[model samples]
Target: MDPINKEGTPKTPTVIFDADKGKVEIRGRSIPENSIEFYKPLVDWLDRYADEAKGNTEVNIQLEYFNTSSSKCILDVFKKLEAVHKKEGREVVINWYYEEDDEDMLEAGEDYQSILKIPFKMIEIQE
Candidate 1:
């Protein structure tokens, strides 16, 4: 399947969903006006990828900020990956990166980790 790549704008995030590389990354801010529209394709792609997933899949999420709607969309993305990990029996790893000083981001990662069954690594980087 073709990969999904979108450049980040001030209101959105940069998305790189490369199935061939078994890597999916979402970086930058995610405060799109319509989060559902912005993330639908990503969710769809993950659904398709679940059917023919290869080795371990690594998901890197580094968001400086995101709105409430975007948060739900992000959860949808995680849920899709969870399906792959649970129902499909694929190894899915989530690396949630945040700046050392960003307590909100750290807590956000922890919250998601608590809600999802997938393994998540909270990576702290120097700001």
Candidate 2:
């Protein structure tokens, strides 16, 4: 599916399944007006991809900020990944990237990582 596009305003965060790189990236601010609306299709896409998901599926989440609703949705997304890992035993890796020196973001990643059994890597990058 094509990435969701909105012009004349900031583009909504996107969850892109890159066929070439065999990776998925969810990047941007996620405090949309409707959290469900923003995340529904992406969740569905993850559900579909996880079924026949091929080789080293890397889920890259780099969000500058997200609301409480987005946090719940994020957990749901992680749960889905965990299920895929358990069910099919795929090489699922969750790379939670954040700006270097961003303690809040780093701590958030740690929180999720603790809950998920998948091999999660916290990546610190230049903002």
Candidate 3:
């Protein structure tokens, strides 16, 4: 999959999916005007990747903030990943990174961790 290039949303994050490396990284503010429009393709990409991804798969998320719609979409993304893990039994690692002062974001990750079985690693990223 081609890496998602940043398109003028300074605070908005970019997405990189490395098929060869079995890694995907999403980092940015996800409060897009049309959240679904932004995330649908990501969901599609992940779905396709899950089909062939083997051994280890890592999805690293570093979002400073997101809207309610974006939150729902993010949950969907994780759910899809969870399905891949359960069905394919892929070794998946989710590293959720938040700023040191962003307790709210960290807590959000914690909440997601509680709901999913995949290894959710909460990390503090220095701004």
Candidate 4:
């Protein structure tokens, strides 16, 4: 399937979902006017990718900030990935990147980890 690549803007994040490489990366800020609309295509793509996913899938999420609405959409994305792991039996790992001193971001990752069945690796990067 074709990949989903979107450039980041002041209010949106960059999204790169490559099925061939079994990798997905989301970075930057996400505060779009319509969070659901912004993430719908991604959810649809994951639905398709779930059936034909690789043995291993890696997701890197490095968002500096996201609003409440985006947070739910992000969780939806994670739920889709979780299905690939739980139902399809594929190995899925999510690398949640946060600044070294961004406790809130780290906590957000921890919250997601607690909610999802997929494995999550908390990665702290330099600010």
The reply for model 1, stretches above 4 Å from the true place, is 87-89
Show pairs that collide, candidate 4. Answer: none
Q: After superposition, how far is residue 31 of candidate 3 from its true place, in Å?
A: 0.5
Rank by lDDT (best first): 4, 1, 3, 2
Please provide, for model 2 over 68-125, each residue's C-alpha lDDT reduced to its tens digit, 9 standing for 90 to 100.
Answer: 8888888888887887777655778899999989999999999999888988999999
- Each candidate's lDDT (Cα)? 0.93, 0.76, 0.81, 0.94
What digit string (tens of lDDT, one per residue) describes model 3 on residues 11-70? Answer: 456877776787878888888777888889878887887777766779899887888878
Worst 10 residues of 1 by lDDT: 82-91
Whole-model lDDT for model 2 versus the true structure? 0.76
Name the candidate, 1 or 4, with the larger lDDT value: 4
Task: Provide the TM-score for each candidate, comma-separated.
Answer: 0.96, 0.84, 0.87, 0.97
Q: Point out where model 2 deviates above 4 Å.
A: 1-11, 19-21
3 or 4, greater by lDDT = 4
**What is the RMSD of candidate 3?**
2.0
lDDT of 4 by residue, 69-113 (tens): 999999999999998988655899999999999999999999999
Stretches of model 4 off by over 4 angstroms after superposition: 87-89
Tens-place lDDT per residue, model 1, 1-56, is 89999999999999999989989999999988899999999999999999978877
